[model samples]
Target: MIDSVQRDSSLLVHFTLKLADGSTAESTRNNGKPALFCLGDGSLSEGLENQLIGLKVGDKHAFALESEDAFGGISPDLIQYFSRRDFMQAGEPEVGAIMLFSGMDGNEMPGVIREISGDSITVDFNHPLAGQTIHFDVEVLEINPVLEAANADPVG
Candidate 1:
């Protein structure tokens, strides 16, 4: 049977992300490879995965998502200040640089430098694309049905 994108389909696709201004933010095509993932997996956002449903192999599509539906709106609370000494071990911090900070959960999170003062640096923890609309150009390359375990029994 021919495969199509559905709730449990696995898909291989190439996609490009662009800003509202037409600037390309990222593209799997640029890397010469397509992304492979299953629907409902964390690899693709729910909003984006929903858009792919019903698409068939070799289908191409373009769409836009608002800030709230994309990466979400920037939060003032995510903007934080840190002492310069904290980064002295790394080097002089520069505005526009991205730094990895340890979170309370013991995971590293990326924060971008937004400002530098005498002894403090302001970092924005929000995603770089936060608060901006994004355009997506996607091409479906392959689609496969989700595999069920051999031991699984079919139920009505």
Candidate 2:
């Protein structure tokens, strides 16, 4: 039998994330390709996955998630300060600039520049949606069932 977003199923979908005031935060519709992700993967938050579970192909749903249920409250610790000299090679750092920095694990981490002092630059590494109530709108286009190995269809 074919799958339709049951447990552990991979899904190709289109999604829009909106803020509490109905402003679009992010959207897959703007991108050329639909997103593909499996259930329980880190691609989605647990609250979001809970809402998407059991949805069948071509199904559309909207979920209103609270700040805690969404990306969770922003942490003050995630805001860090760096020396102005540290950004010299990257050009001048300004407020609201999102820059990619290499972490200890060698992964690219994005931090938004929030303040610029005479010698210190404040950067926030928190998720952009953190501490905000967000609306998740999703449309499931296709389902790919996975067993020990993934035996799925192309998302064309």
**Predicted candidate 1 versus true structure: per-residue lDDT over 35-106, tens digit per residue:** 776887676667887889999989999999888777889999999999988897889988999999999999
Residue 90, model 1: lDDT of 84
Candidate 2, residues 75-121, lDDT tens digits: the string is 99999999999988999987998999989899999999999989999
TM-score of 2: 0.85
| Model 1 lowest lDDT segment of ten | 145-154
Against the hidden true structure, what lDDT does model 2 obtain?
A: 0.86
Native-to-model Cα distance after best TM-score fit, residue 14 in candidate 1, in Å: 0.6
RMSD of each: 4.1, 4.3
Q: How far is candidate 2 from the true structure (C-alpha RMSD, Å)?
A: 4.3
CA deviation > 4 Å runs, candidate 1: 145-156
The C-alpha lDDT values of all candidates are 0.88, 0.86
Name the runs in model 2 displaced over 4 angstroms: 145-156
